[model samples]
Target: MYIGLGIVLIVLGAILAFALNIDIPGVGDDTLGYILMAAGVLAIILSFVATRRRPAGYTTTRESQVDPATGSRVDHTDIDPR
Candidate 1:
């Protein structure tokens, strides 16, 4: 998701820097565009780093047993972190 957002920001920045000619009161279009592009690159890099640091999978367990006194069956389920 962050990667996609970064790509979008980069595209928008490129359009602003190269295609648009409108001027802002306090900021330059090209300058803002370059800033946005840099931020986008940063976001994408961070996303990749975060993904690499995350666990690959979770552990799931299921158990079943017969209660001798009650003559009934019990079921249990659990999920464990990687």
Candidate 2:
């Protein structure tokens, strides 16, 4: 959803900069279009970064966790009952 919006903003900015040949009443040729385009691209990139993609260094290791009730090892394994 946000990615689509970013694409739209980026495309709109590009069009305004290169294709759109319309001049505002009190705005110069180089207005906020470039800023908008940059913002759009940044937003897209941020959305991608904000995804649920974990890095490579993430692991299920617990070598530094300390128990409060008792000084024991934390067993994270699963067991089955018959």
Candidate 3:
């Protein structure tokens, strides 16, 4: 989600910085555009880092038992780690 948002921000910023010709009183269009572009790049990089550090969804485990009365084997399976 953040990656998509970052791409949108970068595209908007590029339009504002280079394609537009409007001039405001206190704020510069080019400056704001550059800031937005920088923010977008940062967002993308952070998103990548966060995704890389996350763990997997589930854990698997197996167990075996002996049925004393019938002298038979049994098995068990567990999905979660904890």
lDDT of each: 0.92, 0.72, 0.89
lDDT of 3 by residue, 9-63 (tens): 8998898899997887899999988988988998899999998887768788999
Residue 69 alpha-carbon offset, candidate 3, angstroms: 19
Tens digits of lDDT, candidate 1, 4-69 = 989998998998899998789899999988998998999999999999999888999999999999
Question: Of 1 and 3, which scores higher on lDDT?
Answer: 1
Query: In model 3, what is the error at residue 26, expressed in angstroms?
Result: 1.0
Error of 1 at 42 (Å): 0.7
User: Best candidate per lDDT, number?
Assistant: 1
C-alpha RMSD values across all candidates: 5.8, 9.1, 3.1
Put down candidate 2 lDDT per residue, 1-82, tens digits, no spaces.
5798899888888878777778788874446578678889998988888774644443343345558889866656433332
* Model 3 RMSD, rounded to 1 decimal: 3.1
Candidate 2 root-mean-square deviation in Å:
9.1
Clash pairs, model 3 backbone:
none
